[model samples]
Target chain A: MTTGFGLNNLPYGVFSTPGTAPRVGVRFGDQVLDLAAALNDPVFASPSLNPFMAQGRARWTEVRARIPAALENGPLHPLTGVHLHMPFEVADYVDFYASEEHATNLGRMFRPDSAPLLPNWKHLPVGYHGRAGTVVPSGTGIVRPSGQRKPPNQRTPDHGPSRRLDVEVEVGFVVGSPSPLGQPIPTSAFADHVFGVCLVNDWSARDIQAWEYVPLGPFLGKSFATSISPWIVPLDALTEARVPTPPQDPAPLPYLTDAEPWGLDLSLTLSLNGHALSHPPYASMYWSPAQMLAHMTVNGASVRTGDLYASGTVSGPDASQRGSFIELTWGGENPLKLHDGSTRTFLEDGDEVTITATAPGTNGEAISFGEVKGRILPIQ
Target chain B: MTTGFGLNNLPYGVFSTPGTAPRVGVRFGDQVLDLAAALNDPVFASPSLNPFMAQGRARWTEVRARIPAALENGPLHPLTGVHLHMPFEVADYVDFYASEEHATNLGRMFRPDSAPLLPNWKHLPVGYHGRAGTVVPSGTGIVRPSGQRKPPNQRTPDHGPSRRLDVEVEVGFVVGSPSPLGQPIPTSAFADHVFGVCLVNDWSARDIQAWEYVPLGPFLGKSFATSISPWIVPLDALTEARVPTPPQDPAPLPYLTDAEPWGLDLSLTLSLNGHALSHPPYASMYWSPAQMLAHMTVNGASVRTGDLYASGTVSGPDASQRGSFIELTWGGENPLKLHDGSTRTFLEDGDEVTITATAPGTNGEAISFGEVKGRILPIQ
Candidate 1:
């Protein structure tokens, strides 16, 4: 389990037979391997999830419910690289802020003038419902968004494609048991409501957002192209990795505090241009994962599985420790001194932001959220 | 306009004649009239919007592009009473919290020890994309939600109906344009994105939220039932009421601050259990309307007319000015002492919550949001 070799990591996705057709299957090693073929022989596939069956609509979901312990020793371990698939899909996706450290840093950045700590902030987990249609699997090419961009000290307004692009590194969690509208789940039952975790890369445009956010918050700075890692690491596998507790002060409003201590000590890294300078561990956040999840449902907004919540630019204010350019350089005023004598206030065209994270004992083969590599394809 | 005739105050809905089916329109004065019946007339309608047949769609969007001065003697004056319906059929609804002040207050209530804002929160406006299906017109019944409510100091949770039921007094801004994905609107173009304003009551369940929000945010506290007033006050009518701009502390991120001063001073009130009480005006905000809209579209999120952006509970410290029970009583630990000698920690069944706002003018008829009221039904 420590090695993350548990069968619970069988990340399944809905796909098509190559042509605009909708199909479903599990992703293994380096291929959209067929789950149906491997199950041709009952004896070879009966142990865990069968091929044609694994590719079946409800297989991943049904298999996701069983404790990770049951599927750990299943016979399918030998069929690691086989091809299989079927038809299953998600109807909706609701992302929750499940990490405490991520939420803590986020709140501090936006609520600097206030207590930065909210009454409900500690008492409840929070999240926003995102567009599922754009919830593409990993490796999808992000389209360069064309929107209004304003520069500092400009008297006459200017418009153009988004030049100030940014990225958010996040671990995506999926729901297994559907939460009934109005039915509240407790902290102990968070696992029951969750199915697995994935990686998400929420792409953003910086320059366009500066002028508009006043009385109301953002309207377009976010909803654009969002990327997610392919694999779905189940909740059962993560239960063992849950940490001691959160460090929120003033205590919570009673409702937000949980019984069992929980936090994941996953190591995360973000590299720009290359894998050299940006990769950092995920442990620096002030809050915990359980706390973020708790805040999301605290509002009683019904949540569904397959939801992708991006921990928005997880960063601590320090060199070699900042998550994105926004924090590393404080919105470009303080340019990041780069290796080759070039200062980076923001990403250049050829820069690719790559994010990776892994639990200890997993060797260096980190469970990564592929990459959101887009050359600032020159504006048309 | 020195009054609070906000873009988020358009209160429109879809209703019908006792003898007919449901259609769309707004409740003006004493008349229950038809916009289609009015906009089609040469004196009332704009020629640019003729492309819409006035049935399926074509809200005030086209005409929304025209400046307010162009319509001084327009047809809106005589549509009183005529039996109004929801202004236009809403194709989509998006809500945002552009007022960083309110968002900041919430952050403080939760995390007392550290920063509560996210790094990306400054680069882009933070928001929770709301559910479109529940975007109902006024006069809708609010069903009391049932779920687990954990109290402070409890080791085990209690499963039952929600006890800490509350209402969020807010303003709803409606969009008038349909922005394509990845296409952002500049600050100057923010008005083109807005069509009007209305009042909204976001219902919340504090109990279920506390226990479940850990790994994710709210699922049951909200999304139960959100109420909106039924009459959209076009953006044209409220511009004259704009007052001095909002004051910002810690200065907003460059992308958020503006040199131009802007905001409305609309007189607003909350009638508890059908009785009126004084609430803070929309003027107490830290950010302005244009700033909020600018932040939203900056990230490339699509903006469609009829979208609703509800400013989080518009509250002040005084109980007479609290926007929600959460703040009025500070999470039930401190209950509000009401005028009727009744103390309110949360809304009770049969208790009606109405949020009304209007921009005062020389004529004194004041452009108002009318009434957004709902009686809590026992959760079955």
Candidate 2:
């Protein structure tokens, strides 16, 4: 119940002082323990976690076991005096539509005359590749994107700043180890390749997405900026968070069947300005991250170090649990009343959004994923 | 012309000899000129073209000007004795629907009741990101991808090897300089950021793409393997190939309007098992590569040095100019007759597909893109 960065949970990140170069560090109780000076390993001195993560899981486990003792005497810096950088260089980014509630809500809003769920939704974890180069660290300023958008009532499309700017709360999985080409990684090997978890804010432009996402999926609407939490919470720290997923009705194909339960009982909170808007339950998601990885590589596609895959917006069964503003505001028909005596249908210029998550840790502490925060900047 | 590797076309590539690591080299006739030894710059000692390409356009021009003179008296090796590797490290891969004929053919085949062309086809270029990690070099064996597919007549989806494996003949534009985050690269700056052109074989599984591309676009269906030509023909070498793009019915938005005609008069030939099948004309494409790049970053998506964007299947009005097997065979209703009297609707096991291209060079000779060849391996 205290601070989430306790002795039981040490999340990794890259930080630097005013004039110093960025290097790997671990968050431990308001201070960053420098891994390079403590471990005497040059890999930790890298600006990104890719070099150490590429050393594979065995080395990761060995180094992680020694982190507690190293923290006792390592060079420590105050968290407030340090600047956080992107933890890893993103290789490829893929976002999946895994939430049944979110998908159903979107389906009903987008296609009122048809069934809520697409036929391929349950058969596979629907996903598409995103702009990896645009993946930024937390606190990056998000400029309001300008593109073509045609509302339902408009005959000709108009080009300008997006009117329906929004955010999607989701969990991100980071790949540490790589797999070979022409080889598919099975669902059971998910933990061996996936290094850790982080929080993601997939900013979206619904008006641009509505006009363009036909036959080829979302592009510029979701690619402008995707923000990620600076710290990465390793899977070892989440041993107490594993839970069984909900029963699947039509049973997935054999390749997607999980040998062990891979669900994490994490809770996410989305906030705008200073008010908490929603708390989406990760357990309510229909598909597991392991199944998503398995499905991604089922066609012999390889994975590389620093690859990031995100679970689509986490939405629960209730209206208050929706992760995206589109669902929360019901396609701009309904507006959310804020504590500051203002109502909002979509994000406005200068509006700031923050997403945070926590999971159960050993010794009854909570493992925090920190927060991914961004402010919408006016068009330049 | 003689071989494509003429003096006028000094295409850059990565190659290695026995027991030697890969390094940057340039093709001058049948010899591989070692740039590291020729230019005395260590950047050419890199295994990929990313390092040299990141030095910006001014540095690229300076280095390119010295290449022809250096080739006269530089250290060289026979091309036959060296092994060609992936020319550059891919940062992000995007595929664009720029061809009018190919889009119309697919639209007619996929949605028979509707108009052949979508409404947004003329207004904006339709594109989607593809897996960058799975992009392999030329001659890499492509494994048959297995995924879920459902024919219209089938009640339920089935999981197995794809029955409609296909290829897309396209031209790829490689980015040589990095752009700032939240900044849009204009259509006029196409040559300033883009380095060169190459051939790409976008191997796709038609069945899987058809089933899953409803709301999210292509994923596993096209992620298995994308083969690119080993050599990259720099833009400076193709001065004579510039032409005006086909007329637009509705004038594009102001941002997409090009200051200069960015169209390239490149002719592509597709061959199956050494038998020439189709001759797709890149000149007939509706949208230019500059327009694709302008629209891609108009929403403030940054592009990296090694980022690659490919023109979608180039097709002409004639049936013999179709770029994909699905179009040539008319969705399997008609089979293509091969030179050996073998009728084929889709790629078979051990089938080798090669795509090559040529553009007008400074001299009367043509500039060749070499070739991107891949053989289909049986499902492992």
| Candidate 2 Cα outliers beyond 4 Å, as residue runs | none
Assign candidate 2 its CAPRI class.
high
In Å, residue A100's CA in model 1 sits off its true spot by: 7.6
Q: lDDT: which candidate is best?
A: 2
Give me the displacement of residue A186 in model 2, in angstroms.
0.9
Q: Calculate model 2's interface RMSD in Å.
A: 0.8
Task: Output the lDDT of residue A110, model 1.
Answer: 53
C-alpha positional error of residue B20 in candidate 2 after TM-score superposition, expressed in Å:
2.2
Could you give the TM-score of chain B for each candidate, in order? Answer: 0.79, 0.99
lDDT of 2: 0.93
- In model 1, what is the error at residue B96, expressed in angstroms? 6.5
lDDT of 1 by residue, A1-380 (tens): 23334342445544444343333334433444333333333422222222322232355455445424333333232223432221223334444443444445545655668654444444444454555434555554455665555565664344456767777666665555555544445666766566566566766666654543332333354556666654556554454455654466656544456657655656566766665545444555444555555545443445443334444455543456556666666556688777778877776666666666665323233343233333343333
